[model samples]
Target: MKSKKIKIMILVIFIVLLFLSIGFYIHKHHQDISTDNAIIDGKTVVLSPKVQGYIKKINVEDNQKISAGDVIMEIDTTDYQVKVDHAQAALLTAKAAISAAQNNAIKAGITAPANVEVSKKKIDAAQATWEKAYADKQRMQMLINSGACSQEQFDQAVATEGSAKATLEQMQAELDASNAAPVIIAASQDTVEQLKAEEKQAKSDLAEAENNLQNTKIIAPMDGRITKRSVEVGSYVEPGTQLCSLVGLDLWITANFKENQLEGMHPGNKVDISVDAFPNLKLTGIVDSFQAGTGSYFSLFPAENATGNFVKTVQRLPVKITFDPLSPEDALLLGPGMSVIPTVHLNKGDV
Candidate 1:
């Protein structure tokens, strides 16, 4: 009977010890963070058109996997091609105009200086003639005063001197007018510059037209799978219209854990993740980073804690978890917005 009593007492003690050990473990490891509020996230691209056009062909079906630069759709390029052709014609016309302007400039450059040189030569010739005629007239005047020449001869010499003087004056005026070579050159250069400016504008227009033509063939910007196809063959699409959503292969997890659970959690901590879609499959990751504020803080309309009496509630911090790059054999089918549960390992010794 004493032995039975001792066994009962020992059993009671063992139960108490077990409870104490469990409580101690709970207190020590309370910083372990776990949350079902997680999702698989990756690069999601919304494909759109830069130029508006009717869809000529849809090269891909829904959820079709494609690589970078793969043709996704072909927009009707007839209008764009016409624009490009018109631009090319305009560019050619501008170039022709430039050539004409250049020729005019060259001709003006030569003509202006040649006119000035010819005017200078004419002034020199006129000066020489005037000087000789005036000398003859003066000699004739002396001859007439001494009665050594006839009146008709003196009158002719005087008329010749006067005509030579008038010719010299006309030549000086011509020289002055033709010496404005700088002004003529400047006017010619201005024409050339105007033509060059027009050429530049034409080139720009041509480039824009070519760019639009290239945009008619829609190509995948990156390797991804297409979803939410909002377009079809023969359907007109406008610029900035949503055509599809592209899901990238590389993905990571976003986990929201309570504030109290952030005590021992840090970047580089290993995480055990389970996808809600595939309960049988398991994944592993490492903590990448934590958001600066709670999820509610970034919501569209955050709670106004300062406006009224506030009830304290546990706040959750968003944490980033990057999965190990999946090998070909272990690549699990996953995508963005998929639900996941993540448990962060709190041991300091692990990588």
Candidate 2:
């Protein structure tokens, strides 16, 4: 009887311990959500040349850390410099042409109206002389018919009147020609305007040439480390040619959690991160945002559920978790594509 009681007591204790363990595990699962489908991600930029030229010099080595605005490489500037010089010369020539045209316009503005007025005055004087001569011819004719004037005198009067009339007509023609002064002025102004347009085009060309010259020097766009250096001292590269790449210092975590697991998840939820490569390192972050779509929805070949027999499948959504300020050493060590495990404390208050 004693042995049976001992065995029964041991059995009851074992059962109680198992139930307590099960209850603790269930409570912990409700409080936290964890997934191993996460990795460190960051910004990456591929460097390319904007202008084509032979590489004259390279100032960066593979995996070299650099800051923004640092010169990474330089292309041959001989051709580009020549282009700039030619553009400058062309602009100067255009400006000279415009100056000459403007001078012609100014001369026309001053001289053309004066010629018109002079021609008008000459026409008025010639009209008066013709009228006087006509009256003299009429008087001579009357006297000659009455035998008071000589025939030679009458003939001289008639010739004088004819000469005066001819002079008046010539003066009228000169006035008509002078009236075209406005047209001449307009033509000169038009030439000035056309030359001015050419000058504007030349200025634009010069600006473009200067821009291309500046592009010859490749500079870092952000604070990063250079990698995949492919160009040598004399490598010929064209526009859009890959010169190298720069990996940015900014880092984040992308955690893919199952659809059912995201029921209580939200942005600003506290998270504990563990890097696979650094087992001893413990990092903290917060949920920044959720991706707009599931991974499969954005995949190259998404499932056509309507066409095939539909089988219910769990989908995963990517959650962006941004780290709290990391130490300088940790920032330098983390990079893109490193595997990580993240546990989100759903019950914990947000940081």
Q: What are the per-model C-alpha RMSD values against the true structure?
A: 4.9, 4.9
Q: How do the predictions measure up, each by TM-score?
A: 0.77, 0.79
Summed backbone clashes in each candidate are: 0, 0
| Model 2 stretches with alpha carbons more than 4 Å out | 1-30, 122-174, 348-351
The candidate that wins on TM-score is 2
lDDT of 1 by residue, 1-351 (tens): 999999999999999999999988776764456888899888989999999989998989887788999989889999999999999999999999999989988998899889999999999999999999999999999999999999999999999999999999999998898988889889889989999999999999999999999998888888878889998888999999898888887889888888987877888888888889889888888999999999999999988888578899999888999997776444537889999999887953331
Q: How far is candidate 1 from the true structure (C-alpha RMSD, Å)?
A: 4.9
Cα lDDT tens digits, model 2, 29-147, are 54789999999998899999999999999999998889999999999999999999999999999999999999999999998899899989998999999999999999999999999
Candidate 1 local lDDT, residue 25: 77
Error of 2 at 231 (Å): 1.0
